[model samples]
Target: METININLTNGYSIKSLCADDFNIVKELCEKCSDYYLLIEGVLPSKKDVDEIFIDLPPNKSYEDKYVLGIFKYDELAGIVDIVRDFPDAGEWMLGLMLIKIDERGNGLGRNVHRALSEWASNLGAKSFRIGVVIDNHKAMKFWSNLGYKKIKEVDMEFTAKKHTVNVMRLQLDE
Candidate 1:
């Protein structure tokens, strides 16, 4: 599906990211080393960058996935990966949403999510879900502040490391 550009209050804009954006994505991922090191216990890899474009849940098509880049003028400031109709119809799954380390703590993440949520809701989304690593306190707090409530905990392996994740859900009441 074609994704539209989302403009933010702070002059940041979000657009669809594709294979052509691999280099920028890699750079952004590298800059956010703290997240990678904390979650996987290692630096980001080429495979990790590649997965942003091709990863999909069972029975989901690539067309259902969206890899979006958040930009500030000409620079990439963050990235968001979302999958439509995952796990169930009308529910979207946010696989990843990382703001450049330098851009954190300024309410940009919240704006990015609000824009994406509006975009998803227009496309028939009834709710949104995300998985936060149990040990990632910052992320847990971020999601909680956005009104996402814990649905359950699940053990999953990512990039050769095992983590217990708190699966959270936010119902989009329209």
Candidate 2:
């Protein structure tokens, strides 16, 4: 992956995270127990943290994935697992985006999304894709508010539980 600048306002910095930051990412997940509970019905495990860096869709490689950490003053505050050209060419897939529990409702998520959007646009992305668990209404609203429209809903198994996912997309400008 080439160097990409993510301009986050409010003293936040975004950078690609690596294995050395596993504990930091795990700690962030621990802080986001509510989200995991809502989606997986359990707190994050070591395997879950590992999946953050290893999991990939069919035909996608590690080279196509970017595990980005959102930080403030050197403290990891959030994470985003994004894949370039996933599902199709000219598209980007947002596998996950999580903000620390205390960081919610402060507009940090929106700022991160905006920065990522601009970055994607600069990369010549034609659109962006994301899948939100149907039960995660707050996330659904967030994506919808950002101009993502529902492309479809599919039943899928996640963490050994059946889930309905709302696959949404935002078409970028030419």
Best of the candidates, lDDT: 1
**lDDT (CA) per prediction:** 0.92, 0.89
| Model 2 lDDT tens row, 17-131 | 9888999999999999888888887889999999999999999998899999998868999999999898999899999999997888899998898888888788778899999
User: Hey, what RMSD does candidate 1 come out at?
Assistant: 1.0
Ten contiguous residues minimizing lDDT sum, candidate 2: 1-10
Candidate 1, residues 1-174: lDDT per residue as tens digits?
Answer: 786688887679999989999999999999999999989889999999999889899999988999999999979999999999988999999999998888999999998989888888989999999999999999999999999999999998876589999999999874
What overall lDDT, based on C-alpha atoms, would model 1 receive against the true structure? 0.92
Best by TM-score: 1
Q: After superposition, how far is residue 164 of candidate 1 from its true place, in Å?
A: 0.8
**Candidate 1 worst ten-residue window by lDDT:** 1-10
**Candidate 1 TM-score versus the reference:** 0.97
